[model samples]
Target: MPVRSPYPDVEIPEISLFDFLFTDFGGRDAEPALIDGGSGASISFAELRGMVEKIAAALAERGIAKGDVVGIFAPNTPYYAAVFHGILRANAIVTSANSLYSPGELAHQLTDSGAKLLFTVSPFLDRAAAAAEQAGLPADSIIVLDAAEGYTSLHDLWGTTAATPAQDTLPTDTAVLPYSSGTTGLAKGVILTHRNLVANLLQIQQMGTVTGDTRILAVLPFFHIYGMTVMMNQGLHANATVITMPKFDLPEFLRIIADHRIQRVYIAPPVAVALAKHPIVDQYDLSCIDIIFSGAAPLDAELGHAMGKRLGCTVLQGYGMTELSPVSHCMPDDRPDLDLNSSGFALPNIVCKLVDPETGEEVGPGGRGELWVKGPNVMVGYLNNPEATAITLDDEGYLHTGDVAEVTEDGVFSIVDRVKELIKYKGYQVPPAELEALLLTNPKIADAAVIGVRDDEGEEVPKAFVVLQDGVELSADDVMAFVAERIAPHKKVRVVEFIDVIPKSASGKILRKDLRAREAAKA
Candidate 1:
């Protein structure tokens, strides 16, 4: 049995996420806000606030009005946070694109959301420019966010423009339009309102897991919502310093904690696997880490507990989807003897129930059923797709998560599987349908099925089991390169194995779980 909190139900607070960004610290000006763990570039709270205002004013000067869509296409940087708040402060929508996305992969998001402006870094300039051209966005609309030396700098926007007064951003106004595939389909833009983001932030805080005094190591990419909302937003709201990384390097990750005396770390299952098995993780001093929260993928309980023993920190797991402002449940650090497999109970103010997918009736406690979540954190719906939105949200407003999960008697929940055709690579959701559509464009491929296979990193990567047409000679490397060329780096097919036919049900739905099992057995 999982530990239960005896604290009575409390009324969930109604607040805007932007309010915390501007008003929380009461002018704590000189404190460190974001520090790059690699390069050691630090931004104080005063400078951060000033940059946000300048960026906001710059966008407004460009005629980007409320409800407009702005694309943020950069890795984790101080400029990234400033641009994000700038767009949201204008009551506009932010479409975050993974920096590793291929030109075509990025073009899809830019076109689908009808984004008017793009803020991107220099290393990605060529790819971003190609994506913009392919998406038909004009050249003037492309804003390069090159803060490093020898490039067009974001600082150029500051002092040239007066900081605009913060606009009236309401709770119902959509702030971030993060893309996610709902219940196994093409990736659709999820309409996350200010209320949705703020609600989940408050819910996670109420779990009594983290605090203002906690120092968080932020390695997860801020382009993704799990890191953006849970790690970055929550850390700043609590007045904690965010030590960020451009990419994951195990030794450097360890040293950041040692140097900064970091107490809290936010990660996904892949990081846990690294900490548990990676030999280099033992090379650094991690004596100061007090808590580790893993989310975005299923974590191995044995490995998590082992981490606790090795690092002397309480490691807990959280569960959520991109649709639920990315955090529906979290297990706190101080909790006693948490179950290794369960994702903990819903936090205060969240409503979760398991229902039969076909019948729509609530399942008994401890029975596996499709997970239905309802709360202020739930998104308004899929943007501009009425059918997908209708199928996802029930008439009574419960968002059908399409996850098969079972709840314990005391409300701890564990996800068995998602009843959709999406694969989680690290923490990013890769839609098989999108990959399948892309694979068909290859001249040598007659048919293809994308499935998740565990790699050496202990994280799942996309593997394409393909059926080559007669007289087509395609090597595994050739097929892999074909995918790498067409899709994002994370969505690239890591392994290519020739198959006669992709196993499918009578209705022609690809049986990916069976494919995953085959890979596991072979391993």
Candidate 2:
């Protein structure tokens, strides 16, 4: 069954990202495209245009064309954007890899996406090389971030003489392929066409969040759609400067805010938690920050207000999934007085409804049910996985967000819980089952269950509730150390506690909400 959109089939223009980047808004010869706070690096729109052109030409020279996948295994740098636009200019798909991913993690994504080219930074050269090799991606297709090591430099492509994209119009062309965080299962490739990207950019901006003068802190990793579309696309679409970071370091984040006089912040729940509870946050001058938007996880109203009170600004939270181009609802920048708990009104051109999971019937206002989203920003479908796509995005085009929420009569919505069992650590998805499967393999572990625990920062961290085997002594530290080596940094179980038995329902499913209640009571 084809997923149907709830939005009225209005004759909206299907503008391409290329058209938006180089034409309708700011074109090739505009002001600076990006600025790096860490290294004071800046690239003008003209330079960015040149870089994209070269990469497009280079891809053409390599026989890559429309629909080819290019893996960008790097951090949040100007080169990242250049390559992203470069891939789109060539009518190819851009799939991003988390810089912190191990070789095994990277290999899965590359192979799943069938990536033909890889752009990687120097720091993770070994991991990227291994991933490309493991995925059977040709060595010749591997392009090093730098040129000194005999690999092609994306920078060198900037000056090369070659024809610009032969196909300039890219309305329906697929531009980016971002994978699900795979918090529940295997990550699936999401095909976002130029129209998908452009519509989302417009939708975010239409929410009245920022202006051309706005300066956003680009701390979120660009690999995720939350950062890729909301941060990179929204920033560029508004002709704003993005301050890039390799990773989130508290001290550095504060310093960048003070240095850049950042006006807006787009961050995840973990970052917001740090701002609310971290002792060091008080020492820095965050007066310039006007708006802070937290997403990728549920943020309690109490914590959201605390951060706003401490920072003396408005704090907003959004709720959505990777399958929806990330932005479904955001606190309208204009409606700062709205309840902080609500994910806020749906963006323009988006229609959302709550349906009772048990009955599949639409729940009225103030009624709790699973969130169903419909908009142009919703994805085309999962790449090469029709079965999963059908399960997630229903026949009516209303994507079952797998999140439970209630919409008030005023149109504001607040999320109660997720129907899914995915745990979010610092805004990154960490599946409990995945961790449980890994833990059961340990000789000393008899039974294990993973649940989220809110730290002092008000962000959830993976905490293992375990019952060790008889005659085996497994310390909490031992359990923590075990997961650290096997998974990505965000997926590591930071806290471990002994539990005699994990409470299960009559059907033998772990009672996670009950566990959450117990944990909260203890806290």
How does each model score on lDDT?
0.81, 0.81
Model 1 clash pairs are: none
Q: Report the lDDT tens digits of candidate 1 across residue range 225-302.
A: 888897788877777788888788888888888998898888888788778877887788898988888898888898
RMSD of each candidate relative to the true structure: 2.8, 3.4
Model 1 lDDT at residue 124: 86
Candidate 2 lDDT by residue in tens digits, 1-523? 1112223343346676876766644443566667887987888777777788888998877777888889998889877888888888887889988878889889989999989999987777889889888999776778866664767777666656778668654677777788884325566788777887777777777676575677888889899998898888787778787888878899999999988899989887667778999999989999999999888877778888999999999888887777777788878788888888888888778877788888978787868988888888788888888887888787878777778988877777889977877777777878888788889989999888888787775567898999899898989999998888877898899889898898889998888888888887886
In terms of TM-score, the best-performing candidate is 1
- How well does candidate 2 score on lDDT at residue 40? 76
Instruction: Return the lDDT, model 1, position 464.
Output: 86
What TM-score would candidate 1 get against the native? 0.93
Report backbone clashes per prediction. 0, 1
